[model samples]
Target: MKSSEADMVFPVLGFTPDGDIWGFPDLDTLTSCGSMTLKKNMQLDMELVDSRGRRWLVRSIRRLGRARPLVPWLIDLLLTAVPRFRIEQVLEEMTPLTLEEIKARASAAVELTSEYYCAEDERDEILVPLLDQVRAASDVAQIHELLGLDSFLSY
Candidate 1:
């Protein structure tokens, strides 16, 4: 790929679990490539869209960076039972930062979804807190309640 096209791929501000996890979504009306939602935690060749509508996959990130649309993240989907994430540091920090703080640094990168149109702003508001909760949560059922995802997760 050309340098410009390659730039579209990385130095992503990846928010991930502290372990090697992978997934699709429970409330999956917006999953990438349509219809891989049943695969559970396997790393399929799927696109990941964040709540703010960013898209890409956990592995898509270049050694340098960071996405698709406005939907719940795949990592959260991977571990439906308990959602959690820490910034996957391409540049290690002395101490870890919170999702909100990292979002602040990433600005439009991770905070504002890749302009999916409707619900972009709302996604940011709903997203951070939900992810924070994901980091702390211990049950899938509880995560579903974050945005009434239970409506879909249970379906």
Candidate 2:
């Protein structure tokens, strides 16, 4: 593919557990072949409409990264088999970084992208605490709630 036609990331919504982990591309090309939704086997298909009212069919959603089915299966087995391992403990242990580490990395990225739109003091005083909560979030719901907080919404 030409550099100008390089793939752009597009978010996909699905019922699968790991769907949120990676995004996809090439929906237009994938759909032009045929509509695959009617088969109703392992493959999944869904219809989506663009802003311009164009209809498209999405087919065969697959995992984006290396499959580690065994690891998760083992973890699930352990969760059921072992009495001592709680889901909370497993989640904490599985998380690669602490909230503070997440905060630092996110802050660096945000500052770089902000283009000096907000002053350092304003960002530190207002945004940092909100982002601190965002980084500290343990679950998806918590992250969404934190994002909806007044401090984040006001700015």
Candidate 3:
């Protein structure tokens, strides 16, 4: 491949979960191709339309860094439950912190939560147990109830 074509295959701001480089065309081409690659890999095709009304196929790949080992169960547990109210309640119960401090804490919490979901190992272990604790907390239950399941359940 010529340098130009090679450049098309690889674009800027591209990194895989394992820290491998993913090369693509220019930003537009990369965006188009990333969608195609994800769809092909996932065996599910979805239509993606650009602002100009051009249609493209797409798929999504879950990328986890070193934090890959804790995601799925985390998603299944916490993400499935917690609502915004519970989050706010937890924040309030933890004692009044400044908004900036709360944001920082929330960000860290989200990162840890995402890490738990991205984990590869399905087996229950130390991390899983701790995550389960968070999931099982009363605040989490309130959040789940607030979110509701009526739409998800159909008669």
Candidate 4:
């Protein structure tokens, strides 16, 4: 079933190395993809149309900025400092979706990215450290462990 804008609750989705997820329903009000007119920012939209022409919206988007890692790391530190980090509340605030849903949207995003940008042959240049975080971790537990406080505390 296609989800309309009304049916979806969260608009902004972001992830931390510690597998911390932040869902901001009002992010667009603060930061925006800018106008859809600019080719540069168009891909920021989570909207994707499938082969069947069904539109699917991905709630989460990778945060891009120089301080992306530092910001999430700081937030994680502050959040963990407060002991009562309820998993249920985290899950509720996070973008909750089935594995299939995540896969579909992820594939769609890759498709769009691949189409827009040319792939580089130099493996080193192509390999992004942030993307590496997602690629290296196989599961949620692994992601959290890799992104845990111990790692951030070092830096």
Candidate 5:
């Protein structure tokens, strides 16, 4: 089932590398594919706080596998100076789906990513708890809160 238009706030959904997923509450601040009116390349400047309470400006590239290698090279160069670093490439467009849909997708992504980097024992200890949080969230706000973005965004 589709989500009500009224329930549609922000279209840009963020997933942290550390296994937290959140959607921006401020629709005005989100630069979603559906909202961008410009023809030229657009840059999404997103700010997120890690578990350590350190703030990070995560620059997302809308078109993946299309940018000149120099762009990412430059970003890598810049990250050398900053300890906190994150990079996101838009893999697909955001669909207007219910919270359940979002959760399912996020959970699947988390599982896939976890499988890629985790050992067998590490998977049970780390991946299970993260996936459980996504499954247990009662609402979008709860998901954001569980992810710790609610506190991060407060400041």
Candidate 6:
């Protein structure tokens, strides 16, 4: 389905990594090919609240094989093929982080990140170092940029 402005498009239906199971209430379409424009009633999202005191509406998938990005409408929809995601929109502006807040947030982020990605040694190596940079960052912008997030950010 698409936003009311028609500027962004989202998928209502998603299959598991094995392509065996599907999700969402709309049971009409399941195949990997098709086109339909839908008016927004709901969006499926898995949100993560980062230590930076912002909430990210995230959709995630994991798999081993390579997956090519789909067309413009479905672009950045991270299936197993899509490794990670970038911020499409900033829901709100948060208060500027004080030096103490920055340090606390960075520490918290590192701990969470390490725990989350620790078990999966098969994951990308670059991300591990990036988190370390985030921990050592003196400014929030550095952390945000290192995460490859939010082109909308006016830096």
Error of 6 at 105 (Å): 1.1
Best by TM-score: 5
What tens digits encode model 1's per-residue C-alpha lDDT throughout 1-155? 21122222122223333212222242122222212222242223323323332344433212111122224446544555332221121112224344444334333332333233236667657656655665554333233343232111221
| C-alpha local distance difference test of each model | 0.31, 0.31, 0.28, 0.32, 0.43, 0.32
Which whole-number lDDT from 0 to 100 does residue 4 have in model 3?
Answer: 20
Q: Which stretches of candidate 3 lie over 4 Å from their true place?
A: 1-11, 34-36, 40-155
**TM-score ranking of the models:** 5, 6, 4, 2, 1, 3
Winner by TM-score between candidate 2 and candidate 1: 2
Estimate the TM-score of every prediction: 0.22, 0.24, 0.18, 0.26, 0.39, 0.29
Give the clashing pairs for model 4: none
Using lDDT as the measure, the top candidate is 5
- In candidate 2, what are the lDDT values of residues 1-155, reduced to their tens digit? 21112232232111112121111133332221111222222123333222122223333333222112567646744564421111100000112334344334434444454433356668768666766665775543344344431110001
TM-score of decoy 5? 0.39
Q: How close is candidate 6 to the true structure, as a TM-score?
A: 0.29
Q: Which residue pairs of candidate 5 clash? A: none
Report the candidate with higher TM-score, 3 versus 4. Answer: 4
User: Candidate 2: deviation at residue 149, Å?
Assistant: 12
- Residue 75 local lDDT, model 6: 51
